[model samples]
Target: MRPSGNAVPAARRPLAALDEPVRVEYRTVHGYRRAFLRAGSGPVLLLVHGIGDSADTWRDLIPVLARDHTVIAPDLLGHGRSDKPRADYSVAAYANAMRDLLGILDVDRVTLVGHSLGGGVAMQFAYQYPERVERLVLVSTGGVGRDVNPVLRLVSLPYMDQLMHLLRLPTTKVVGRVGAAAVRRLPLDLGYDVDDLLRIFEALPDAQSRSAVTRTLRAVVDWRGQVVTMLDRCYLARAVPTLLVWGRHDTIVPVDHAFVAHAAMPGSRLEVFEGSGHFPHHCEPARFLGVLQEFLAATQPAGHDTDAWRRLLRYGRGDGATDAGAHLADQALAQSHRTAT
Candidate 1:
């Protein structure tokens, strides 16, 4: 929504930077355009991005993990270079798109990592495709309970689709021009601050990026209160070598929410990044990658499936992630930089 006469900054913002291109494509069916970046080699790692973000959001962390993993990050159907379909915006829709993408890529088993809205999607994917997933990482995810981030409540509100359609248009340049001006007038509403929050949010308006923000929010309300409840319940039912990472200062999704997820998945370990916000990968890159690497590496397959993973899935003790580490140079190198799209 623009300001009175000119474009004024609204609550929505833009990313700090764009990412390097890898492989790009658009599926004709949903007009889903995507980019694939391959990094490192060991086990395959599939990355899911947060709402209002593309695979590029992982730019700072991908290279770190890439050293140890064949990372796959896509720009979901309607984000990045991805096509903007006239429809399909629900979280389930996002998961379905990922399922299709994975099938096309012929990925069998993967360690799935998701952030923010992406985290919720990761959990949902694990629930639906347990056999395909080797392990799980959820960063500041939802679907745990009612303690949603305040800003998220605004984005997840019902009837936001019509609102999205009306506002999401023009290219990033146009939106940026107007948004920056409006931001000058708009008071900062977000409660948390790592830096100049208003200045960062004023950057929104990149056509593809902005549209993504619009779609995810509008379509998220499409759930009708079913899937959120389902995923929350599923967390307790299935334990897939889970690793929960959260930032103490995450305003988008509070760090406290990790407690609910940790409680849900009995054996899952929660790592707290002190002073970091929603984008732990960005705010606390080194630590985030180290913890992630340690967890994934620990879950690597031995001659036999590990007891830790089995124990996590409640199938007896199984081999899996959640191992704390002091050094993860190789893993950090691959995952530290580079993003999915």
Candidate 2:
């Protein structure tokens, strides 16, 4: 499973395999079966997917990561093979689910990596239980700034769930394929993001999946733009080793947020893929793997210190909430500004 220099990610893979089998396993959480793929045996690496995606989204990077780390990719509630209950889909909920899932699996510590929506969840997970996280990797993550794609904002609208239902009609696939083909013929350079979105749309053949999708979207987004943000709390990561990865061409979530976030977290590392889009790991597997491996090797895993965390929370690093806390508060105010127009 060595990464090739010029390998383009396949649209789909039959299965992700390491030197050993990457088998899909399930854990019953809140009476729902949460499906996950686990392989290798070393430092635990938890991979979380974004909205409209599943654990399978990590297929391109899992095998390579598995070479030296235990990779755990889970299908979040309402996505993939996991049961989509009429449950809360907020970042905090997802973080708690991951915590409980790790508890069941007896995994105490991990290098947490998350993409898009998963990134927000990863941040929340680290904040809630800092002791459980060894390191942090955020790739094209949301909740940094309120600059999400317009379509995602539309999906957050109150009545869009009904519209999404209509899109699941039997003839929708035929119409989508025709539209996708037409788009391909145009001179415009729309990458695979449209195709990926269409595929995600087609996946919602049932009401449960559709409900989950809409609920999840509405939890993080609103008609105004992104309503949930982690910038306010990113100061908490000062003691943790953090890496920021983004695609310069990403339209889904602007790459500029990565720079702002990197600055916000004093010691974080930022890597930008020059010509890549939202899924940089998929588009540039070799480079992504190399960067991740190098970061993991260079940094030491973080350990929780109760006294320091308490002091930081109580007095906020000597400046009396005038430094990191001030900047974070400003970001929170900016996040509240309406950007949908």
Candidate 3:
């Protein structure tokens, strides 16, 4: 069913108009309010943002995608305008929350597009509820490798919560803004990422937000690096249309993880944005939307086959063979361990 909303005419509008404002809506689930942006009317496309970001991250792309599809971008629990509380901030929990939110909105299945932490959530959602996902678009996704930014590893360390408290000081905030401004002027790859990084940094000052971010980070990461790896299950991508997008110069998650993940997931498409950082969608909105639209047009949505899913679970690739899948799984794990050490 199409999402019930006033449809914006596609003809009169430019494809990626940043001036367009997508209204925010709220729905109460499990005693907390969840904020989301819903627009357009066609097949469902759910956009999940990375950690410390709100639904507003997709502001520029929403108007473009909404012209042809029903787009739903939700601020995951404990972030954005959504209520942040002491709760389970694990990837699996966030996946379940997406399920409930979509159910409430009467969306049964979706072409899921996720970035960074949200990409990990998309993978977990696809794994947990395969029937509910039609396609997967992982952009600078986590859980594919062990190497992450040292800063994130530090954030996952114990007692970082108190340090976050110190960052909330007025003088500290001013200094941070100035630093971010200076970074934007530098000739560095991080210059493209500083704004989003600054937003995440700004959010950390809140007590509840700090706890939420800390718990979320610790769930999939540690002082060593990322602990969760999806390589073992990459074979499942054969049953679903998967697209992997990454910035060639991503320092936070590293672009190498994209190649590793692409190698593991058979038939998955990979697009590396040159001169882009962690936020490729923001860095190259036109190219990002073009690649996405092309993928959508070329590939048909995956229909959930219950028996096929069961076979894939039991036999790895539903080909009655476990050796190849097992080998790939082992290789992925070994690579992760090697990186961690």
Judged by lDDT, which candidate is best? 3
Superposed by TM-score, candidate 3 places the C-alpha of residue 126 at a distance from the truth, in angstroms, of 0.7
Please tell me which model should have the higher lDDT, number 1 or number 3: 3
Candidate 3 versus truth, CA RMSD in Å, comes to: 6.1
lDDT string, candidate 3, 1-341, tens digits: 21112221132123556543577899999999999998888999999988777777776678888878899999899887788888988888999999999999998999999999999899889888888888999999998878899989998999999988888889988998888789879888788687667766665546888888788888888988998877767576577899999999787999978877777777789999996789888777778889999998888999888887777778865442245644544565786652210
- Where is model 2 more than 4 Å wrong at Cα? 1-18, 182-189, 317-333, 337-341
Q: What are the runs in model 1 whose C-alpha is more than 4 Å off?
A: 1-31, 155-212, 221-227, 230-232, 235-239, 301-341
Model 2: colliding residue pairs: none
lDDT of each: 0.58, 0.80, 0.81
lDDT of 3 at 292: 95
* Global CA lDDT computed for model 2: 0.80
Steric overlap count per candidate:
37, 0, 0
Residues 192-304, candidate 1, lDDT per residue (tens digit)?
33232333333344555555566666544322221253222343224467788887877655565676556546567799887466666766666777798788767643122
Off by over 4 Å in 3: 1-21, 317-330, 335-341
* TM-scores, all models, native as reference: 0.68, 0.88, 0.88
